[model samples]
Target: MVDSPRIAIDAMGGDTGLAVMLAGAEAAYRQDGALRFLLVGDEAAIREALTRHAELAEASEILHAPDRIAGEDKPSQAIRRAKTTSMGLAIDAVKTGRAGAAVSAGNTGALMAMAKLALRTIKGIDRPALAALLPTLGNNDVVMLDLGANTDCDARNLIQFAVMGAAYARSALELAQPRVALLNIGTEELKGTDEVRDAAAMLRQADYLPLQFTGFIEGDRMSRGDVDVIVCDGFSGNVALKTIEGTARFVADLLRRAFTSSLRSKIGFLISRPATELLRHHLDPNNHNGAIFLGLNGLVVKSHGSANANGVANAIRLAARLVRDDLTRRISEDLANFDTHKGPEAVTA
Candidate 1:
């Protein structure tokens, strides 16, 4: 008997299907006493998984969507015609106000298409970007938008991403007026392709420019603590982000190999166990498991495709918190008043 508290999760949408997703729901319920989940997927599979977790079984509600959005199918076509797909059901739960948020790690393209077609945008947002919240140094984090949504973007779309990303930084990261940086090869005005240069000019003339804009953030400065939001086309942002992720994993693996190389190295590892564990946990992608598809009418989180139970649970919890934060409303309000916030007049992006 789930009452007002509910989260819709695509239990059959991930790589491991209902097994991992049920484990995640159990974890989320254990972590937060007030949270309840509305699991969506194949009924038989979900029931069997829940039978293993008594507590979660008692608090969860299962909904059968009857179909799945396969990883290879084209999102546009699949979303449009796959009426009984799990992705559609989970999103429908939010659209009908039956659930607070939706979580999935299935085919991202399918999820995005279904969500937009179902919930639409939140007034000002033209193209909804998939904004991934990356963990930064200190107690803060920055917002990176267009993670893999739209490959081609104009000057206006980039600026919109800046504003939306800044607002997300403010509400999500609690920044006063988040420093928004355009991803570029160099910080100089003369640098970058014509597209980036044109975007820079458009951003410079923006009324919100003085307060939010940070000119350009070069590839080397990505880890710097100065910027709170980085805006770029989906193609560039996704490539740079994936590169960083790959590098982090590579470094961690190299360290692991070194630590286990010999008896002497093993002894040294014993001495540095705590420090090494901290670093390993910090670099683990599962530790930073959840990502937001920002600019939608409601909050949604996409976990990794290969995410395990703990990762899935973490993603559900992340979506629940974001839904509680009123992120959609906050973003809309902030962008609505961009002209009054700071440099040039308001322009569509």
Candidate 2:
């Protein structure tokens, strides 16, 4: 029997609930025997799913959590009710060292609330941010932070995001000099709102990260893969994320219409089938299935609720990789450096 750390999964969180979670855990365990799991949610549902996928019974176990944190629940209220939810229980497991990490395809706000209220954030990490990542240009994916965590932030918060994000980029993405940039209204120093300009100034002086600190990146430039870490307030960051998702859908719909509109266009699409296949693979959500809630005391991954088995499996694989890499320790050490190289705040006229 191969022994490995087990990941705690909130089986009740996603849209498909226990079924998809079970399939994911089973598939992952079969692929990598070293991966064990704890499905934390409604006991009866978990047991039923387990029977349906009985071969993984030994490698996986169920931990009952009677209540659920609804996706619509306010973050503040969810934090108070954290103990009752499966995601909260899973986070508790990680905190107690019973699990290597926690995986949830549930309420994003609730997960953040539970993790912060239960597991706590590392010192110097003012507020934890969600880095929803996907492959960008140059085989590099950008880490955009505060993705619906804290709506308003100060300089120190943005600085912490950079430090943690850089460590993640280095460890996860293998980027030697992950270029960190502030997401702003404009690339020029003078063109953004007061908050963005001030944040940019702070990042320029805050020198804790091993990653290269680039100036500013506009939202339009995000697709160009201009920066490795994109820092912004949660409000702006969430907007950017939704915009990207919407644009991808719009483009795909447009492509389908273009290809099927005429026989000549269909023939051209067939001739270009290889390149099209490559592009589709590159843009597939399943291929980029996990988002890391960084700065938490331990690794916590959130997958889209609509994820199929492959997506859930990918999330577990991501958590396992993060655990083995000792990501939390590395991030802590790097965050400790924030006080070292930080210069006097830039004087803006």
Candidate 3:
């Protein structure tokens, strides 16, 4: 039997609390029986929850945490309590090598802060970016980065994001040479802020990199099925991600209302039920639940605080896959190749 890496989970982190977290872990265990878990939270609560999942209970171990990071807590405040909180202990497991990766459905800011502080950035990486998979009309999902990690970034930061985003796409999407584009106001070379244009220029010049720099892509064209990786600063990227998610919900809700408007519409809905179901599945956030903190020395996956058992299971599965694939080493190798080929100099020139 293949020995899968043990995943450390913040059992008390999400809005739904321990029951959902344990259920999610159990679901993942059912999918991959070889998977193991290190559950971090109030020991009595975790133990109580596990009793309902006998198989998962046998496959898991619990670590007691006296505290929990509240949703309103600031990152700084959370950091001070790192050694005692479930979220903090989960991340520390990755840092100490007790777990291959950490997964938490907690405050985004606190999770990012704790993970960065605990794992630090990879050798050549200056900052880690939040990257996630967005459903697109394309054959594969698109990889978008800087999803609220760094609000303000320079040309160099954007360039680095492009590289890391590409590496993530290659690993998660299994692309040979991901087509990358800078998210901009327009596709015109002269459009967008100075940092964006500069990043585009640098990407265009760096032919030695594994990614194919396809110039700037507009926000409206993000889901057009052409680009594989979209790079932007946290300010713009966060706004874009939220907008995309909101629009998806809007469309899904609109369709439901429209189909129930009248008998005729309801009959039509039944006729198109198959198509609508596919569309619903495509827009479901649970299908794509994990957002990764790329460039960190160790892997850390952020699950939506409101995510359900299936969503949490998806996050756990994602963390396991990233560990098995050795994603951090892959990014480090690509970063080294970029430096060795004088990519920075080429970009500056």
Candidate 4:
């Protein structure tokens, strides 16, 4: 009976389906005995899965949801079916204060649409951004935002993302006075679009904020580990994120082929197995499994749809950490303190 925050899980959402979700929940419960769960999905399937893990059954409560949003469903289509769907019910748990946060390995667009509609944006936020931790060459992970949430954004939107992203870095990465930057094609002050320039100007003038605004950062410098939080609209952020992931896979495949190409290479690979394993562990997507919908009233973490049990467990842990750390309150407080003239108050009613 270790007491911890309860997280809502959309049990029918992932690629591997209910069994993997339950297995992940069991793994999370085993790793952190304090954590509790609200498993939302088909009651029969959930119960069947739960029987395999008695301890998880003890720690979890199932909420039967007759339907589930599909991976191919568009955001517009998904939002209309919110009431009957597992993803919607999981998010509703957060809205109704029944759960501290919601975790889903579901349709990314659908999850975002449902969350935004159900929880609404935080008072000072214009749009919620999808933020995630990316492994960096430095000592800690870098927080990058608008990973695919808002494809088009203005200067004010970018500024809000900066504040939210910085607050998230503080809460999740345990960083003090995080260094923030805008992602642009060039590092020059005069480069990039008017939106980027305006956002940079605003951030640079925001001296009262807790984060240090380091002007512009080019995409090539992203992995250098100097900046803590990187902000950009969804279009570029998504492209950058996908490019990095593809490059990682390309390098990994090359390594595999090279190692098996020759007998001598295979021998060398055998000798370097330990180092290679360490590299694989570090680069595995499961280690960085959660992508958060920031700027919302509550925490909503979207795990990769194809994630295994280990990845789902990591996502659950992330939601739990944010809940315990009170991430929403921190973001709200930060926004409240922002100058009204330049904040969301100026743009939104």
**Top-lDDT candidate index:** 4
* Least accurate 10 contiguous residues by lDDT in model 3: 340-349
Per-residue alpha-carbon lDDT of candidate 2 for residues 137-232, written as tens digits (9 for 90 to 100)? 867878788788889877667777888888888877778879998888777899777777776777676554587889988888887887888888
| lDDT, ranked from best to worst | 4, 3, 2, 1
For each candidate, give its TM-score against the true structure.
0.90, 0.90, 0.96, 0.97
Which candidate has the highest TM-score of all? 4
Give lDDT per model, in order.
Answer: 0.80, 0.83, 0.90, 0.91
lDDT string, candidate 1, 143-246, tens digits: 78889898998776787788778767776676787888899888999988777777778667665432467699987777767788899999999998898898
What would the TM-score be for candidate 3 when compared with the true structure? 0.96
Distance from true position, residue 273, model 4, in Å?
0.9
Tell me the spans in candidate 3 whose CA falls farther than 4 Å from its real position.
1-3, 343-349
Model 4 lDDT per residue over 1-349, tens place: 2149999999999788898888988899999999999999999989987889899999999999999999899999999989899999999999999999999999998999899999999987889999999998999889999898888999889988998999999988898799999999999899999999999988887887789999898888898899999999999999999999999999999999999999999999999999999999999999999999998889999999999999999999999999998999998887876755455554332
Model 1 CA deviation exceeding 4 Å by range: 1-5, 202-211, 339-346
- Report how far residue 213 has shifted in candidate 1, in Å: 2.1
Candidate 1: lDDT of 216?
91
lDDT of 1: 0.80
